[model samples]
Target: MRIRIVGTGRAVPAERLTTRALEAKLSLAEGALEAVTGVVERYVCSAESQIDLACAAAALALADAGVEPGAVDLIIGGCGVPYQPLPATAPLGMQRLGMADGAAAAFD
Candidate 1:
């Protein structure tokens, strides 16, 4: 079957730490980490959970796609590692997306 990605979105925490600040904190030479990693800054999660971030991005994606939650046929979630290691993150994402259980298939 052919698949189409209708939209995309991104979310980041309110707080951010720049590479230079990180370098100073780590006592590394300024610009060293950015030179190697090519990262300018990163968001720092204070009280947000993985699901919270994922859902925020998903909400934007859904809005961008002009699709309602019930219109989704499937939901797939992934991460470098499971955030909590139980009750997989996908179902939570689906719920947060406002899709009812059984409305769409979800998997991590």
Candidate 2:
């Protein structure tokens, strides 16, 4: 079987942080991280739960793919940050997306 990446989505925090802005927080020279990483700005997740971000990203991805959330057979989320200690991030995301219990799986 050939699996398809029907949807792709990304989420960034409401707050925008730039390399120059971080300089004050880290006491580093301006563009110091940017010089090495080539990243001028990065999104940081807010106090909001990771599941919220995942759900938002998933919704966008599904919309881009022209698929309905209930039609999704599976959902795989790979994130460096996780929302909680007990339950995996994916289940929470699935719940947020209103997917059936067995319709999808999430990984983080």
Candidate 3:
């Protein structure tokens, strides 16, 4: 079988937590976290769930691929936490993207 990556997408919350903020939260010296992690800021969700973020990213990826949600054959959820307890998060993302019949896989 031949496999290829067709598209890509990204989404981030409106709220932003800078490295200085993280340093303050951790009680570390200013710029310490940045020195260690090399990250200047982080996006935090105010109202959107992780699932919502994932779905948004997936929608963009599909759009970039010029593919509709129904055309998706498989969906993989890479979140560390599941959106719900009963059903898997991958299916939730797929459903949110309107791909109810697509196959799904959830990985940490």
TM-score of each: 0.86, 0.80, 0.79
Summarize candidate 1's per-residue lDDT along 1-108 as a digit string, tens digits: 978999888888889999999999999999999999999999898988888989999889989999888888888888767877667899889987778888888888
Worst 10 residues of 3 by lDDT: 99-108
Give per-residue CA lDDT, model 2, range 30-70, as digits (tens): 77888888988887766756777778788889988999888
CA lDDT, every prediction?
A: 0.88, 0.78, 0.78
Candidate RMSDs in Å, in order, are 1.6, 2.1, 2.5
lDDT, model 3 = 0.78
- Looking at candidate 1, the ten consecutive residues that score lowest on lDDT are 79-88
On lDDT, the leading prediction is 1
Question: Can you list the residue pairs that collide in candidate 3?
Answer: none
Q: Candidate 2 clashing pairs?
A: none
* Top TM-score model: 1
Clashes of 3: 0
